[model samples]
Structures are given as structure tokens and as C-alpha cells.
Target: MSEKPVRLAVCVVTYQEPFAHSAVCKSLAGLPQELLAHLSVVSVCNAAHGTIADDPVIEEHQAGALSYREVLRSDNRGLAGGYNAGLQIALDEAPDAALFLNADGWVEAWYLTWLLDGLRRQPDREAFVPTLISGARCVSPFRKRGIALNFYIIGWLCLRDGPFLRQLRFPDEFWLDGIDYWLSVKMAEAGLRIERTERCIAHNLSVSDQFGTLPGWRYRNILVSERRFLRWQKRPFREILVVHVRALARCLRYRRFDLAQVVAKEFAVALHE
Candidate 1:
């Protein structure tokens, strides 16, 4: 007898934008039936601008084969809260693997299959981060020797098993800014495997390009997030200092003094923490 297929669940947290929401739905709709048969989708709608859960685009594309659930909220609960809402529903189904996908990002048709295949090939790995396709020239400046850092996994696609996530506790207080780092750090500390590969791929909606004009709250989030991340990760003082220095330089080069201030403030907080 053949073995049962692994169950996969995807949680997409969306706020305001309907077009982007539909885009993700359409992308998922195009997945092969073999995968879709065991796939469940949860769309958390935190529509501060307007309603998107009822948008015809999402309704039409999120039908057939795959199981779908919608959690609609009137206020924007931020990234972590929105994802936690959808995750709660997905976890109830107890999927073999669950992915936290951003509403503005979409993976290729074969992304899920490739990731599952890789995990199957290497069963030890608990978490997988897909390569990001974006318009930004330099997404992260924190390079080790020459290789660039992988800071893009936070919002793109954080795919992992249910059991592992439950152990670490999914998306906590640091969810707003350093969520990706937090999860990666915890997984490493727990001796769980995390691998980054090109086979599984996703595309960002060029949102990082607008980092210069982000709201003040986002900068504040970054400050708070880094302090928490530094404490939890137990990174050396020199490494953290160098990273913030580079960050300040980058912000100034981009004429975003506001962001530079955020970097400085985070460094100051880190000193006390």
C-alpha cells in the first residue's frame, strides 16, 4: 500500500490591499492538484483600508481542491497577531508542515513540491527558507566576509513543521521586526536544522524599496526588535556593533536619517540590555 501524503497548511496574513491579496490567492490556485489535495490555506484579513476576505478575486481563486479558511478582523493587528490568528486555525488541522506566507508575496508553482521533496530527502532539517526574488539591488548589508546575510526570510516564507514550531512557540512579542531572526535563532539553539535553497522560490512585492518612507512606528518596532533579538540570540557585542554601524551608514546613504536614528537608538538600547 502507498503511504499517505504529508499535509501542508499555508497561512497568509493580509492587510488593506485587495489586489495583492488576490495575487497570492491566484498564485496558490495554480499549484498542482497533487499538492493541493493535501494543502490547507488560511487567509487572515486585517483590513484596515477595506475588506478583502470577500473580494471576488480571492473567493474565485481560493476554491476547489484545497481547504480554505478566512479570519477577518476590522483593525490591523500587525504582522505577528495576524499570522497567529491564521496559524491557530491551521494548527487545529495538524498539518505535517505549515508555512507563514506574506499576502504581498507569492511562490512559484513548484515551490511547495520542491521544498517538501528536499525535506523528505533530508529528514533532519526542520525549517526551510526559500530564496527571494525581489527588485532591490542590495536587500541586506550585513555580510560575513563576502556572503550577504539572509534577513529576507522574515516576511517572505517561513516554512516549518507544526511540532517544531509548537516547541518554540509561534510568533511572539518580537514578531513585528525580528521574527525571522528570532525563529532562526531558536531553531538553531534547539539543534534543529534550517536550510536555505534556491529550489523553493518566492517573489516580494518590492515593499522593501519603500523602507525610506516607512511610518515612525515601524522604525520604533525595529529598535525594540533588535534589542530583543540581541538578548535572545546572545550575539557578541562586537558583531552587533558592526551591524548597526553598517545599518546607520546605509540609512544615511539612502537619505533616511530617520532610519539612521532608529539604528542608533537600537544600539543604545542594546547597551543597557
Candidate 2:
């Protein structure tokens, strides 16, 4: 009998950048047809303009490899709510695995292959992470000392094809990517094994980015999210400092004193809030 094509779902959460999201969907269409068969997309869009149907890449592919679906939202939950909406669709569809990708990331076939491999081998407990590359450096490829340091757009893989669970454990509250710090926690609760893959995916870290640019809305979101971030991801004072150390230095380098001010003021000793 012929091997069954993987029923994969790529769920993207995006805001105001249509082209960036298009690049992501393009990557999906660009995947070799061997892997693209039976793949579907769930675009949980937060902006009024990011209509997935109009993406040129999708037009070019004609949903060739990817069937598209959307969840248009106007909520402030940001990553949390967006992901919740996507996962809901995934749950209903009962796909083998769903990749929760950020809209701005550019993915490659090898990473998707890796995700499928894990899902095929152990769909119930397997959650794969692709090597995250930024500016030529491999960032957060593996679990560092038991904690993930800024997991890049390889993002979360929610599994359902296996025998363990029926649905994904969704994030409760996060603004933009304040959710990154909370992802592993939810995976742990869901009994998923976090696996690091050797394949690399380049994340521009430019579009739909917060920590890099901290645009007006993102900056304000940061201010709104700081207390909870400090509360939940509380670690040692030194570790917390180390996390923001680069952010602080960036403030001095690019003259982003505003972000620096927030970092210095908001990122103090971690305590129960």
C-alpha cells in the first residue's frame, strides 16, 4: 500500500504585516509537493488588512499544496488569543500535528520534514523545535539548562493524531510574544516532549517583531505585559538581568532609551506580583 500523506496544519498568528505573512505562506507552497499533500493552513489574523486569501503566493500556488482557512479576530490577547483560535480549528480538524508559526518567519522544508518525522514517530508526545537562526547565529536550538531561550518561529507543535490527547493546551494570557516564555510551561502541562531538531530555519527577526523594534503598539504592549511576564517567568535576579542585558545594551547602541527606560524600570527583582 502507498504511504499515507501527512495531514499537517500550519497555523500562523499575524498582525499588521501582510507581506511578511505572505512570505511564510509562500514557504508553505514552496515546500516540495511530496510534503505538501494534504497540508492545510489556519491564519489567525489580528489586523484588518492581513487577508490570507489575497496573498500573491497563495494565488500562485492556488492553494496547490495548502488549503487555507482564517480566523479573523479583534482581540488584545495577541499571541494567546490568536493561538487559541488557531488551535481550536486544529482540534476540530483532528490533524496529525499543527505547527503554530509566527507570521513573520521564513521557514524551510527541512524543518517541516523534521516536524513530520517526530509526529509520525510519536504524535502524542512529540513537540519539535527547529534550529532558530538570527543574523548568522544559531539561537535557542536546544533546551538551555532546562529553559528555552526565546524559541523562534518554529513555535509550538500541537499533536492529536496519537493516543495521548484530544486537543492542544492553549496559552491563557500574553501580549505579542510575551507568550514565548509561557509556551514550554503549557507543553509541559500537556505532557509533550520538547525535541530539538538539527535542521535550521532563518528568522528575519524584522517583521512582526517586538523585542527588536518595539514599535509604538508593541512598546505599549510590553508595558502592559511586563508585570505578568515578571510574575510567571520569575527566575533569579541575575538570570532576569542576563535576559534583558542585551536589550539594555541595544537601548544604548541604537539610542532606544525609551525601551531602556522600560527595561531598567520594569525589570527589577523578580517577585510574586
Candidate 3:
């Protein structure tokens, strides 16, 4: 008898570019046959405007070693919604793990192989994120507690509150990773063991705020998501103050007073639903 090779759902969420020419497809097209045998791609697309629906690449990928499935919708549901749609389908097959990738990005084949080995070594981990490399920086291996608490909110403030950030190319994912942050808080509350990984993925800032505009609508969603998390954690008044003060300062500094207002106006937006 032999041990079965690990099966992975290489899940991607996208709203732009043709499916065949996407970073995910280009990478998949280059993968070795044996590796491809152990993988399936779950593509959740929010753009039905000929992005994935009419592309021949999905059929092409299905015809080869890779098994492919996609959920297409015209309505925009943000990142986590798209991820859930694809991951749910992938999970039905009981894959060993699901690797989520930024759709506007690519990962090296060796890193994918390394990730599988790491997953095998630590089968109990609830998740494993490759070091996300974009430009000269990366987001990886932050302590679990650091993210689950007010740090993410604080970072969002500092980035927006910075006078020069508007002119710089800062990544706004600190707020965008709210889904993962809340999950970390739950794991922390449960006393679950936390783990980290070293492999890397390159998230090319193609369709997102590559130039750090820090749009007002983005802020509203970010703050509302954090507000929901804080309430769920039953955080005290002062801890909440630490975040609000910084946010208020950013509002004044940017003259984007609407951010402070819309966070409440759009409180109905669901981070998990």
C-alpha cells in the first residue's frame, strides 16, 4: 500500500482579464503533468461580462490534467464572497487543502510544491498562506494575535493617516483581509495552536488600488468590517477608542469626511455573508 498524494484546490477569485491569459492559467499551463494530476482549479468570477463565461481556456484546462470548475456572477461581492463560492465547491470534494490566490497574480511552481510539502508536514493547520510578494515588500507570518486584535485597524489608520501615502504605492489589504482576521480571532479565542509558512506568491497589483488612492467607499467597508469584529469580540470602550481616534484623524487629514459618515450608513454590508 502507498500513501495517497495530497490533493489541492487551487482556488482563484477574479474580476478582470481573460481566463486563458490570466496569471493563474499561465501558471497552470506551465505546471508538470504529475503535479497537475493532484490539483483542481476553482475559479469564482464576479465579472460575467465575457471574463470567464465565454473563454475557451476553462474547457481547455478541463481537457488536460487539471480539473476545473467556476462560479460566475455579475454582481460584485468583494473578495471573501468570491473565495467562499469557489472554496465551497472545492471543499465538497474533500481536498487535503485549499490554496487561495490573488487572481491578479502568479506563484512559482516550486513554491506550490513547497506548499504541498509544508501542508503534509503540518496537516492539522487550518490554513497556510504563502508569503505574498508584491513589488519589494511581502505580507507573511505576522503573529496570529497581532492580526486578530486592533493591529489591523491601527495599520489601516496609519496607512491612510500618512501624509505621503497617497503619493506612494501602499497595499490596502490590511483592511481587505478582514475575513481572515476574524477567523484568527476565533482560533485565538479557542486556544488553537497558530502556525505560519515561508513559501511565497506574487500578487501583482493589477486591478486593485495599486497607487494607494484609498477611496472613500473602501474606507467605509473597512471600518464597518472592523466595527463588526470588535463587537463580536466584546472589546471594551477604550480599545475601540484607540481605533476611532486614528480614523477620525485620517478623515480630517484627507478631507474625506464622508468615510466617517459612511461607515455607519453602510453598516448593513456583511463581511462574512
Candidate 4:
């Protein structure tokens, strides 16, 4: 006559970082036994040309309290593909929620517990996310300045409810960039709520050093993704222009002339289309 606990699937998509994945598994394994009993760990290995097959820690922890599953792929399908592959398997189990965990990061056990409680408190919400930590920085760009949107999220512990999965899926065109932004927009368009937790926080390996040296291909992808997203949203040319103009100014301020030029060209294309 007791109420059943909600089932959760923690889907982690990893490429070649076995050590990071192991650390993540270790962190999950350390969760409270009662909490672990209601969750499953799904690790998607997206290694293209590596001999490594399985993660022992994930397998070993499977027997104890938490259930674990791994989806092995021989080709690199990028982030969306990898996550979708694992998501399909997780979806088959019909869990109450699925948390997309970054392989390069780990979450505090208490944070996840808090997130689950928040989800229960807000049943109307389609998704819940924990505040993120990387070194000394908080992932919320506007949090420190007291300006935060209701739907600002970045793929860490993105706990999507059953209704969310029934309505939306990750786009196929998305490879490595813009999927998260696209999803946030899609959810907002659908009038679905995505709440951010206050006490819960996930830690990620900081990549602040690479921001300044991002390659041209990445910039090009950003431009294309922004255009595609705006067009999909049916945004007006003037609105797109305002967005690009601000982006152009930011690029120029950062001395990224190459990206500034790309943004200018994209703005023209958006104007015409």
C-alpha cells in the first residue's frame, strides 16, 4: 500500500574520456542507497576508433543498489546523436524522468536528491536543472547580476519529465552545438516550464582557457545554428538584426574580427531570408 518511488535514468554521453566517465560513475555510486535504488545509470560510449569496450566501474556498481546500462557505439555521432542513442534505450524503460549528465562532469549526491524533490513539488514543469559550478564560476551568466530567465539551461542534469519526452526530442541536425539553446526555445514555445534549483549544483571540468582560442569552424557553426534557430522560431528580420548587431559588437570588442565578419555576413543573409 506504499507509494512507489519515481524512476530516473541518468544518461551520460561520453566520447573518449574514460577517466572522466569513471569519475562520474564513482560519484553516482556514492549516492545514498535509497536514492540509488530508484535510479538507473545509462552510459553511452561514442568512441569511433578505440579498442576500449566497457567501463568496469559502471558495470561493478550495477550489482549493488543502482541499475546500470551502457550503449556502445563504434562511430562518433556527435553530442546529439550519442545522447539520442542512449536516450532511446532509456526511454524504453519508461522512467519518470531522465537526467542528461555530461561525461566531463559530476554532480553532488545531495544536489540530485534536491532536484528530485523540486520536480515533485512542481509537477507542471517539464524539466528541472541544477545550478552548475566550474572552478570559481557559476554557469548562470545573469545570476550574479540578478537577471535570469525562466528557461536558461545548459545540459547539465536536464531532468525532463514524461510529458517533455512525449512532445520534444533532440533535433537530428544538431551535432555539437546549439541543441541546448534550441531545446530551451522549443520548450518555451510549447509553454512548458523548466525550473532551476537553488541548492543543487553540479561541477564540471573548467574549459575557460579554450574560450579565447576557439577555432573558425566553431564560429561558423555558431552563426549557422543561430540563423537556423531564429528562422525556425519565425523571428522577424529586424529582431534578427538586433541580435546579430549586438553579437557583432561583442565580437569586435573581443578582437575576434574573423567571427565579426562571419556574423556580419550572416546578418545580411538573415535579412534577405
Cα-lDDT of candidate 2: 0.59
Ranking by lDDT: 4, 1, 2, 3
Looking at model 3, the pairs that clash are none
Q: TM-scores, in order shown?
A: 0.73, 0.73, 0.66, 0.73
Report the Cα lDDT for candidate 4: 0.65
**Model 4, span 173-256: residue lDDT tens:** 666666766666666667766676675364542224354676767766766776676667666566566667877886777788
Which residues of candidate 2, in runs, are more than 4 Å off? 16-21, 49-65, 122-125, 142-169, 189-191, 206-213, 216-227, 233-246, 264-273
Candidate 1 lDDT tens digits, 1-273: 976577777878777654234666777767778777867887876764555444322342345454577766766666777777777777878777777776666667666776667556766767766666555443321223322243445544545665666654545677567766666555555665666665434353322556666765676676577656665656667766776787778788888887777787778876786
> What number of clashing residue pairs does each candidate have, in the order they appear?
0, 0, 0, 0
Tens-digit lDDT string for candidate 3 (1-273): 977888877667677444555666676767888788777777866665654434322332363455577666665565656665665566667677666666556556776676677666765554444455566666433442224332111110101111221122212333254665654454445444334445555454321323236667666656666666666667654544555666766666666666656543543343222
Judged by lDDT against the true structure, how good is candidate 1?
Answer: 0.64
Q: What shift in Å separates residue 249 of candidate 3 from its native position after superposition?
A: 4.0
1-273: candidate 2 lDDT, tens digit per residue: 975667777778777554234667777767797777757777776654544543222221254555577665544346777777666676677677777776656667777777677666764456666667677776554343435543433364444455433444445667565565555555566566667766666665542233556564455455445445654666455555555575578767777777777666555533323
Candidate 2 has which clashing residue pairs, if any?
A: none
lDDT of each: 0.64, 0.59, 0.53, 0.65
Better of 1 and 3 by lDDT: 1
Error of 1 at 22 (Å): 4.4
